[model samples]
Target: MGSFYVTTPIYYVNAEPHLGHAYTTIVGDALTRWHRLLGDDVTYLTGTDEHGLKIRQAADAAGTTPQEFCDRIAPAFQRAWERLDIANDDFIRTTEPRHHAAVRELLQRCYDAGDIELDTYSGKYCVACEEYYTDDELLDDGLCPIHKRPVDHFEEENYFFRLSRFQDRLLDWYAAHPGAIVPEFRANEALGLIRGGLRDFSVSRTSLDWGIPLPWDSDHVAYVWFDALTNYLSAVGFGDPAQDHTQRWPVDYHLIGKDIIRHHCVYWPAMLMSAGVELPKGWAVGGWLLVDGEKMAKSTGNVVNPLDLVDTVGVDGFRYYVLADTTYGSDGDFSYDGLVARYNADLANNLGNLMARVATVVAKKCDGVGPAPRADSPLADAAAAAVAGATTGWDAVSPSRALEATWGLIRATNAHLEANEPWKADPGAEVDAVMGDALEALRIIAVLTHPAVPGTAAQIWERLGMTGALDDQRIPDAVSWGGYPGGTDIVKGDPLFPRIAS
Candidate 1:
């Protein structure tokens, strides 16, 4: 089997999980599921970035040690993933011993390569951002543009990474890998930043006591980028240079938010070059999920608790809204009204209605046994086309496009059933042909759309009297024109997504 590795940015464990966090993890989960359907060997990784100044501050605010605070907050992320049906292969925490070892090794390699050197540094830093910012980057009154807070000035001795030296190399890599950064516009943004100029960034902090200590120089700890980025390699056995890390060395994709495009696209590749490592295969950047046209933030008191939505809408309903409503690489507004509308229109009205209608007709007209679909039916042809679209769309990481394409099959099936009116037609060969085709369409829809709306899809599969894991079925083939078997007992279930009145 071909190999595919994907990772979501390990979340910072300074706060409770929110809708933004859920949005990215769900995307990763859906992508992983799609790859599995294609019969590829996939390793999906996500976890908490537990060691940082932010975590330390959060711990101090809670009157606990950093480790104790991380121990508590990290589980919140794990539990949220479990509740949301995230299927990550591993969750690597930065504070874990394996991660520490990897960070030390990566730091030492860059230092030994003459790219890391001791330097006296002085700058205006944003505690919220955990990075220094130039005067041009600051807003009026020298505040952080993102946090809208005043910046702090400090002078200290630190170790700096020679990022400026690799600007030409990064430009060359991007030139060779045109599609390395996604959303074309974002790629342009990264290129523009590189063209503007490059600066050597400090890689060690003497002022922070809550991070991984620099290997050769014990007085300092590795900074955020150096410490956090190492989690990707650490999880894949990077510290054990004796072992071949080639299997997982070149990550297929790094799914990150647009806010950190500079860190991932610019700084990361430069760091890899310094250490003589292969760059990531690609970077898939997604925009923020805004609430009421404002970014979700704790200070704004606008952060939506993802668990509350999951409880109300159900996991699959929540997942479907996240993937379908938002076009990849664009900001999506979240509201209770919007969520309810989508759940009702797409889930309850379109997909759920199709399943219930098919099963009801089979039970009433076909004596509760689903007849095998006719090979030459028009419904089968339409389903085949929809399945093909879904396969291609998902392969491109366009989840919204994939779901829209899959829903075309749903719409076609609804139209076919309405046109034939199998329930109204007399019980005969023609009626069986129509109902049979509809059942087959349901089967195809179940397999093809399972990645987006898994819980409801699996339920529909069971109601149609199908056996085996729906997830195990291959894409396109499972939804192909002629795979539905005949003469199976049809079981009708309650409305999969009951509509909520507005």
Candidate 2:
């Protein structure tokens, strides 16, 4: 069995889970689900980044201890995932004992390599971001680019990582491994940062009391990136070198937002090199989901609560929009009008309409029993083309493209049914052949679309009288154009997607 590992950025628990957090987790969930359908051994990991200065400040305002605050907010993430049907294999929190052990081991390895050293630093800091910014990075009013608020000046004694020393090594690595950073444009951005000159980054903070203490020195705690990034390895048993992280480590991919491409594509690779570990196979950078041409933010009160959408549109409906609307690397705008439009067009019209029409025809014309498809059906050719297109899109980690390709097959199947009009014909070999071809197309669609809209896909599978877990079906092969064995009972069930008023 081939093994694959993928992760979402561990979300900071200072706020409740938002659509942005849900977006990455759902993408990871969809990719892992796709891999599983291909018969690969997959590990999907996501969790909360509980230990950080931001969390400490939020806890103070709430009149609670940091741990207590985290304990309360962490469940929001887990519950959200559950509600969204996210199939993550593990949820690792930085506060977990296993995670703490792994972080210390990783820090010690880098420390012994002379990559970490004590230093004094002063800069404009954003408490919300838990990061310092240079004057050039700050706005005219000394505000953080992301938060758009005045940053505070802070000075402290801290341990720094010698990131500047590895600039040449990082460039060399990127040279040998092209396309390591996605979209080609993001790769150029990373190269620009490296050529501009790398700066040594502080890895520990003296003023924060809510983070993991430095293993050798308890006076300070590990900074946000160091503590948070370690969750990827720590979740898979990387802390204990003797443990078999070989099954999951040297991760196949790290899915992150485009804003953090530098950290994941640049600083992260350098940190791994300093620890004498192999780098991740790839970095899949995604653009932000904007609302009204602005990035979603809590302070601005523009954050879209994912649950609100889930309540309005079902879980699968929300999942479908996120995966189908955005090109993986390009920024996407989110609007209620857009969601409802997609739900009506793709779900209520295309997929749901196709399923309902086929089942209704089978019930009326074929005594509620599906017949076998003809040997030379045109629907077979369309299914083959759709499968190929979707497989290529998934390989590139573009969920939107994959869904688009899959929907092409769906629309084609609907067109084929329209050309034949099986409902208008008598119950005979001709009607059986046409309806049979449509049923076969539905089967392939159920398997191919299982990753994006799992609940709805399974419903289609059962409506066709198929057995076994829909998720266990392998891709390309499961959708191999002519796999539906006919002469099975078909049921005209309730509408898969009820139309929602705009």
Candidate 3:
């Protein structure tokens, strides 16, 4: 089987986890699960970016050492991931020794190749952004554009990566690998950045002591972006000569927020080219999760804890809202009312209602045993079409669209039941056939939606009396027509989704 590697940007450890962090992590988790469902060897990596001025400041304010502070905050992320059912293959923290070794090696290679140079630079810097802003780029109030916060003026002698030289090279690489960036428009944006000009970016800071010290020069520490970006390669054994890193070197996708597109698409790739590392295969850029039409910020108390959302709605319900309410690449405006509405409509009213109705009919009509769906069932063709839609939608990396396609089957099945009135029919072979088809339709749905709502899928699977692990069931055959054998003991469980009152 071919290998598929995917990574979410290692989160910064200045604060606890929030909805923004959970959003990207969940997308990565879902995609990785999808790959596994297709039987591809998959690796998913996510972790903390611990070495930065923000972390250092936060640590100082907490009256703890930076390492101690990172240790305390890092597990918050891990614990959140665990609670959210994230199944990452590995979690690589920047403070790990492996990460340090890899970052140093990468920096040294670029330095040796003459791409890194000592330069005296002065600019308006945003510690939160870890980026320099020119006069024109700054906001009208002379604040950093991204954070809308004050800027720190600094001048220093530091090492700069020759990013200016890679503009043409980046264009050439994108030319060779068209569609490497998703949402097509985002690719156009990257080209716009290249078509405009690239400036050399500093990769080392002399004043920072919390970061990894450059190998060639002990006095200067690697800048946060330089140090942080290497975690992608460091986790895959890029520094170790004995390890076979090539098997997973080129990742299938790098899922990141749109704010970091310049860093990942431009600066990171240029640094890799300077160090002779292969570039990433693709990037799936996501828009921000907005609260009140503003970006979620902990400083402003606008951040929403993902766990709190879990408490309000079940994990599957929350996941469904996030993945279904907004298109993958578009900004999603979050609201409690919207969440409840989508949950009640899709889960409680549509899929959940369908399951409850089917199981109840089977109990009274088929003696509580699932009947095999007839070959001539009308839904068989509808199921086939839904399956193809879901497969293709996910291939485009659009979870919302995939789920929409899967819900199409649910809507159709409910319509089929309404038209035939299976529950109203007399007990006989005809009623058995009707309820049997509905149960079979649910079996297909469980397989189709497992990636997005795994827990709910498991519940449906056990209620259906399927024996083996839902994951172990092969696709294309499991999801194909007529997988639910007749005469299996079917249990009519509680409502899969309880509606929240308006």
Candidate 4:
């Protein structure tokens, strides 16, 4: 089997998990699930960035040590992912000994390569961002562009990475690897940062005690960004001599939010180049899930706890809405009304409606045993079209378009049932043909939509009395028309997604 490795940015452990975090993780999980469907050997990694100044401060305020604080808060993310049904292969923390070794080895490589040097620097720094910003980069109010808060001035003696030297190299790398960053515009944005100017960034901090210490300099700790970014390498056994890291080195995709574009796109590649490590194959940058036209944050008091909505809309309903409503690369405005509308229209009305109608009709007309579909079924062309569009969309990381294509088949099947009025027929061949086509359509849908809504898709599969685990179903062959060999007992159980009252 071919190999596919993907990672979600290890989340900062300063806050509890929220919808913004959920959005990115769910997208990664969906993409990995799609890879599994294609019969690829897939590895999905996600975890917490547990060591940083923010963590120390947050821990101090909570009357705990940094490690204790991380231990307490990191599980919140694990639990949240579990509740949302995320199937990540490993969750690496920056504070782990494995991560520490990886960070040190990377630092030593760059240091020995003459890329890291001691330097004295003074700059305006945003503690919230944990990075320095130039005067021109700041907002009109002399505040951070991201946090909209005043930055503190810091001058210190530290070690810096020769990022300035990699401008030409990074440009050449991007030129060689076209479409390394998704949403072509974001790739251009990275190119702009490199073309505009390159500055050597500080890699070690003298004042931060809550981070991985530099191996060369016992007086300093590795920058949080550097420490956090290496989780990708460490989880794959980058620094462990016992493990063969090359099996999954050079991740297929480093899924991240657009806010950290500079770090992942610019700083990350430069560090890898300096350490003589292979650059990531690709980066999928996603826009923020905004609330009332602003980024969701604890400071804004607009953070939507994903668990709070789980009770209202079932997990699959929530998952379907996020993947179907947002275009994946664009900023999505999250509103209660929008959420309810998407859940109602897509889940409650479209997919759930299709499954219920097919099973009910088969039970009433075909004596509860699904009839075999025709090789020349009317939905054959529609199913083929859907599989084509969905394959393209998922390949391009466009979940909304992929799901839209899948839903098109649902809409078409519903129309086919309506046009034929299979229920009105007297259990005849005509009714059998139409109902059989609908059943076949549903089976194809279960495979197509499994990545986005696995739980709901499995339920549909079980209700159809298909033998074996739904997860065992592979793509292409499984999705082809006429795979649903009918004659299985069809269970018209409870509504898959009951409509939520507006």
For candidate 3, the lDDT comes to: 0.90
Error of 3 at 392 (Å): 1.3
Task: Report model 1's TM-score to 2 decimal places.
Answer: 0.98
Candidate 1 per-residue lDDT, tens place, 1-502, comes to: 5888999999999999999999999998998888888888899999999877888899999999999999999999999999999989999999998899889888888998999999999999998889899999999788998989999997999999998898889899999999887777888989998998999999988888999999998899999988998888888988876666678779988999999898999989988888878899988889999999999988889999999998888999999999999987888999999999999998899888888888888888889898888878988668767877887777777789889988999999999988888878877788889888888989888887788888888888888888888888886467678787988898877888888887
Q: Which ten residues in a row have the lowest lDDT in candidate 1?
A: 240-249
For residue 3, give model 2's deviation from the true position in Å: 0.7
Best by TM-score: 4
Q: What lDDT does model 1 reach? A: 0.88
Candidate 4: tens digits of C-alpha lDDT, residues 1-502: 5899999999999999999999999999999998999999999999999987899999999999999999999999999999999999999988899999999999999999999999999999999999999999999999999999999999999899989999999999999999989989889988999999999898888988998889978899998888989899999999999998889988999999999888999999999998889999999999999999999998889999999988899888788878887888899999889999989988888899989989888989999999888999989999999999999998888888889999989999989988988878899888889988998999999999899999999999999888888889999899999988889999999999999998
Over the stretch 362-439, how does candidate 2's per-residue lDDT look in tens digits? 989988999887768888888888788888888888999889999998999999988988878888989988888899
Local error of candidate 2 at 433, Å?
1.0
State in Å the error of residue 414, model 4: 0.6
Write model 3 residue lDDT over 297-346, tens digit each, in one string.
97678999999989878898888888888888889999989999999999
| Top lDDT prediction, candidate number | 4
Total clashes in model 2, counting residue pairs 3 or more apart in sequence or in different chains: 0
Local distance difference test, per candidate?
0.88, 0.90, 0.90, 0.92
